[model samples]
Target chain A: MWLRLNLRHRIYAILTALVIITISGGLVMVWYTYRMERLFSGIIGRDLVGFQVAAALEASLVHQKGFVSYYYLDGDPEWLRRLGEYRQIFKERLREAEILSDTPRQQEILESIRSEYNEYIQIKDRVIDYYKTGQRKALADVHPQLRELFFHIVDQCEVYKHIFTDQIQEARAEAHDQAEQLRYVAGAAILLELLLALFLAFVLVSHILGPVRRLTLAAEGGEGPGRIDNEITALSRSVRGLIQDAGQVHLELERSREHLLQSEKMALVGKLAAGTAHSIRNPLTSVKMRLFSLGRSLVLSDTQKEDFEVISQEIRHIDTIVQNFLEFSRPPKLQFQEISPSTVVDMALQLLSHRLDAYDATVTLQRSNPLPTISGDPEQLKEVLVNLIVNACEAMGRGGAIVIREETAVLPRVGKAAVIHLSDNGPGMSEAVAAKAVQPFFTTKDEGTGLGLSIALRILEEHEGTLNIQSAEGEGATFTIALPVKGADT
Target chain B: MKTGFDILITDHNPHVRRFIAREMTAAGYRVQEAECGADVLFQVSGNKAVDLLILDPDLPDIDSAVLLQRLRKRTPALPVVIHAFSSDMEDHPEYLKSDRFVEKRGASIEHLKEVIQDLLIRR
Candidate 1:
């Protein structure tokens, strides 16, 4: 249950417990010391004074004993006067002892001592009177009795002194017992404090420091030693890194989702377009045949002939569009053959020679060396080349010069590849158009099917190749084609 | 005025078949029409000497690949002209195994006539 608390709460609980123990233990020690101080004051200020007064009373009683005897012997009335003075002193000391008395037992003993001393004094005074009256027999008998009273009073005073002494002894003993109790309590508090300290250390080490060390290691990917002094600092750095990585992953996932949605939409459109194109093919073919037969059979004026030719040309254009849709929707099976890329290039130029002448475009093939042989569909490659050339020609409109450069290079991730760079000396495309040039159905031309570059890219991808378009407004466009060499492991 | 060569024209569309048959008949060859795979097979199995077979790959009754395979097995020496869209021919290159491929287009009749003349002369 203790382990379930988080680092902050765990430290808080331990610190709180430690503080409570320390404060309560300190308070108990303080209270014990105060009690001890009060006990010592009581013993010194009251008990010790009471004991001293009791002794003084005993001394005065003894002094009067000898003074009364001296009066009996010398007959000097000055001795009698000194005896009265000692009596006064003894009475004053008894009063002081009574006032100092604290417990009921000590007060009672003092009262008994006062009564006995009074009795003793009265008997002694009687003896003095007998002496003064010159009654020798009576004086001797009373003197003996007086001597016994004096001894009894002195014994009572001794008992009163013992009472105060006993109180002092009791106070000392009580203080000792309290000090012993305080010792035990202090020892227990110290032991408890030690245990709490150890527990706090244990919690900090195992629960906090251990995990933080491990977290720092994991966050650093076990790459480096502890460079940061503070563990939390390193952890925060790692957390920042992880957060950044998570953000990038989220962005990538969003992009992929959008791309998937776009591909699915294109796939759906392709399916619909293919179906429509296939259905239209048969009827379109019948119309073509009828037109063919009509033109061949009928005799017509030049205007009629021109109209007929225009209609036929429009029908052919529609057919071409339908064919493009079908081709885009259903990719043809590639016929891979071992051939040099230069061969395909030559074929494309030969095929497009008449179109080039019509468009007034000149092509210069930079055949430094025949391109490396690769396994690909030559017909599809030729088609792509022809399409690019035709587009370049149309862009230039007239007097366009196209340069075809071919080479072999080792491309990263594609290994050895046959690279073809077809650059046209014509007005290039804007960045936006260039970026979307390979997208299906994205076209700048009015009469374009817009599947040319898309189909070219698709065909290149099937051959494990790439098509890259580099163009800027007012600058000529450069189309780079890279086809991986056969048997080259990337 | 019919020539010695007998031609079989197969297509799912009746109008296309009718026109091609008309064109071929006018060109002095005896032409027969088959609208479906079954009809084409039935006509080919008949005793009539079909010197040539111009077949559209897309038919109603059977899979084109299977029909082409069957036709190749039934008449190994017969020259079959695949008269279909170029896109269709590209999709199924096995159709290229036929004697000739003539894309059905506006000016395709001249190409088709030339192919037929070449095939009959070779036969």
Candidate 2:
């Protein structure tokens, strides 16, 4: 869930958590230290007060004994004054013990110490007064009682000191245990802070830094050192899609460029053909005239006559090829008319009838009836038909049946149209040859001008029609001419 | 048509010139062949008194149009026929003053013979 947060929010959240953990750890340490300090201070303070009261009471008892000795031995007035000061110190020490006692047992012990000191002080005073009257026997008997009272007070002070010492020991042990616990807590707090810092670093690396690095690599086309994640994967897929789209556009551009080059080639061929035909025509005409004159002037045997006839025939064939080239260079301007496609087809067939028969090829004109009149140049249409039929015949060198069919069909990029199919049962062409078949000046036959289909395709294109062919190796070829119908869009 | 009138033929192709010379010579006209523009000028300035000039526009040595203009200045009344290839046979207005033009194509030789016979008969 935290990983889904955006980078900024994730960083901010981790920082906040780290801060809170640090502050809470510090607070826990402070609270533990304060509680331990208060408990240790309470225990040790009561014991120190008890020890002070015991020491003061012991000093007071020793001073009282010394003062009584001085007064009995010298009977000096200064000794009496010092005796009073000792008496006052003893009373103050007892008062301190009374105030220091809190528990009922200690309070009761302190009350006994107070009463014993009071009785000893009163007996010492009566003995001092008898001494002043010169009765030493009274002094001697009371002194023993005073000395016993001082011994009892001494025992009480020793008992309170022992209690204070034991309590102080207990306080020291308790404070030591608490100090050990606080040290452990402070150590745990530091460890917890370290863990928090480490966790934030992990989040920054995995959630923020790692993903950002991956994103950078994805942007730079996966060339960097980063692993793939979903966003990067998706970005790469789209980039690939864009590249593929550009590739397709480049392919289309290359195809269009090829077409432009082919057209340019055709234009060059036109210029070349025009120049070449005229150059060759002059000598050809001269040769024909000379041959005519020679033939008229001389008589020849039957064999020589036959040879002359062959030469004349070959010369005529050359002339025809030259004429064909001239025609290719200058196609006739189209004269559009509504003409029956069947008429043009039949006309071409009749013209090639002899050649067809010589090849022993049978042509089946399916539905030899009148097709719907299409708007096109009849003479040009006839020429297109003648060229295609002649090509079909040439393809079927030995003999093969050709099927000619006509019908209304829908063509791609054009509407409903009239389609003519001229199929030959001869050896078909490979896909490569079939593709370049309509390109001008592309020829397979040694004697081919390669202009037949090229001119036909140009003429058909002038009428906004298309010539398409389909063939596979070893099978026959099918040449299809699709012309838009009368009312159909070109 | 004419027994022995002087005529000049100018062309770069020697074979074409030979053929035309032979045909015109057989027809009884005194025929002379020049292979270039300089040859035309050389033959025309001589005492041959050329009656007609048949020229092909493609010349080896100097521009043919310039030679034709110079030839016209030298022999203004000499009937001139341009026997040119079809592609170069542009009927420019400046060249229309030539007596005739015969495009080298089908029936061009026959037409040239007729033009020559007519020009000779008129001469």
Q: Tens digit of lDDT per residue, candidate 2, span A384-447? A: 9988888888888868899999887777755777778999998999999999898766899866
TM-score of chain A of each: 0.84, 0.52
- Top DockQ hit: 1
Candidate 2 regions exceeding 4 Å error are A1-237, A257-289, A315-382, A394-420, A424-447, A454-466, A472-475, A482-490, B1-7, B37-53, B61-84, B90-111, B118-123
DockQ of candidate 1 (2 decimals): 0.74
Assess each prediction's global lDDT (C-alpha) against the native.
Answer: 0.86, 0.80
Give the alpha carbon lDDT tens digit for every residue of A314-413 in model 1: 8888888888888889876888999999999999999998999998888888888898899999999999999999999989888999999999889885
Report lDDT (Cα) of residue B13, candidate 2.
72
Whole-model lDDT for model 1 versus the true structure? 0.86
